[model samples]
Target: MNQYPDPHQGEPWQQPSGGNPGWGLPPEPHTGGQLEPYGNPTGGYQPAGMGGMPEPTEPTLDTIGDIAITQNTVITPSGRFPIRGTVWTTTDMSRTEQSTPVWAIIVAILFIWTCLLSLLFLLVKDTKTTGHIQVTVQGGGHYHATQIMVSNSAYVQHVQQQVNYARSLAA
Candidate 1:
């Protein structure tokens, strides 16, 4: 055996020829595609349209807004409700109050031993809001209630605006 075989030499079956790149088989017919439902070249398969199977069609959907509403349904966080004859209700359950922060109380206690000026820290006031608004929808044999957390009166007003939009949609 030679360390480096001559490039001119190849297997007995190897021959340089530019006929068809297809492996030995003749070129296939230009049918729509290989995976098309057309009949095979052989007699076993039937022609495309001759088959008993029906052509498939995609179902179209009617939607409103981004994805919350459809032709007959109003999708919500709590559940789906009928858009027709639907009712929307909102209740504000938030309360706001002013109080001294825990850090301020702690600071006042730690510095009270040093001087009377430390008592001023107790005067620091913070306004905080806590609670959520409950929204309820009922119609077409269904009922659902969902709560939207509110941090301030502005957010409560925003929720009211959204409910108003829903009312318009229902009407």
Candidate 2:
């Protein structure tokens, strides 16, 4: 039996005109007005300028105020921690405290009164301050906490004042 010829075997395929059919015909010859790139006819989304995106700015620490308080020792089952000082900022209240062992303090006071042994304070891990004040923005459900490092009672009071000021501003 003879095989039937393929429908498209000899017909010449026509080439598509210059413009893409999906994107419509080429834009009309540029008039006096500016011509946008091929795809975007309206020229709505222009190429970014020389600077590209603006550089992100760093967050600034705003010092609202300070406070003064008596030095105290915090006793824990592990040991006693001394509060050397405190500081409060718009962000958080930080305490400068000592986490020296009682034995070490006694040895330093008695045998090493020259205070040279106090240098060992750097080795003590918990001696660093670890406190933060978290404030929730009114109506926004957003919360921000500032970690306290070296601050005094005045700083804590200042933070309270800042919180009140923020609340008043929100109102």
Candidate 3:
């Protein structure tokens, strides 16, 4: 037992320089047994050596497309959970166009009508000579002149009804 070196001196088991051939310290106290095999044999309380290892999980599929549109919304109040997502795709070339409103179209029609009425008022006189009327009677005879008066009045009434209908639709 006196031939072995001290364990605290970092020396392996060896015979003293000139001692007997097969002599060494028998064993030490406080080391349980030999100190060579010191790590946990049960994998540090893990089942079947699963310590320091991640669990195995199933594989997931990735989505792809030629054209895609994506929108995301989030709730900002408390007690709401977080959301994470992604969209994968290629190119997109779509758009939406605006149209003129019905009221604007009606106003345009009324403005045009006012311009035409002003032009007509400036060009035509309110009264004419009876000779001009007699020439009109000679040009178309009596029956055709009466028919023209009736049709002209009917067309004016029809135009008035159409204008009223358009105004109602605008409202």
Candidate 4:
């Protein structure tokens, strides 16, 4: 194979004028290239800025509202304790009250031709939740408890998830 371009006859594959068509040069970056943080595929590509790529911001603590939890530290308005082992407990202080809705009473009164069958609407009970759940987390050398207002059972579950994450961090 001929390594050098023939001076007498220009070859179609050969560059018009260049040293091996940039083969010996360093790789050039693509203009406005995309970047994924920490090589995580799910992080997605961020647009390259004129100032270049920014440093990734690692969280010092995982936070849930006012509470910030780390592997060895728990921070809250009450205080910060360097916890070694963590324990979590939740007290369901919430209560749901059962009552007849006004709409049910109205339906029963408006459709009384069937009498007993229509009155069955009055048996429809509407449940309303009231109160809060007391989430208490205590371990190592200190304890902190907070009350989260409960609008429904799902809200309590959300609080529980937060507590669970904190517990994992504390551990």
TM-score of each: 0.45, 0.26, 0.16, 0.55
What residue pairs clash in candidate 2, if any at all? 66-154, 67-154, 67-155, 68-154, 86-151, 86-152, 87-151, 87-152, 88-155
Return the clash pairs for model 1, or none: none
| Tens digit of per-residue lDDT, candidate 4, span 38-121 | 867658744332367552433556655466676666666665556467677888899888999999999999989867699999
Name model 4 segments beyond 4 Å from true: 1-65, 114-116
lDDT of 3 at 24: 45
Per-residue lDDT of 45-113 in model 2, one digit per residue for the tens? 443323675323323223332211122321222222222322222555455576766666566567556
Compare candidates 2 and 3 on lDDT and give the better one: 2
Most lDDT-accurate candidate: 4
Best candidate per TM-score, number?
A: 4
Query: 1-171 in candidate 3: lDDT tens per residue?
Result: 656566675534353444654444444558554444447674332222136464233231211111111121111111111112321111212223345555555555667665654333333323221111100011111111111111233443443443333233223
TM-score of 3: 0.16
Worst 10 residues of 4 by lDDT: 49-58
lDDT of 2 at 100: 62
- Residue 127, model 3: Cα distance from true site in angstroms: 50
For residue 112, model 2's alpha carbon misses the true position, in angstroms, by: 16
TM-score of 1: 0.45
Q: How far does residue 110 in candidate 3 sit from its true spot (Å)?
A: 1.6
lDDT for model 2, on a 0 to 1 scale? 0.41
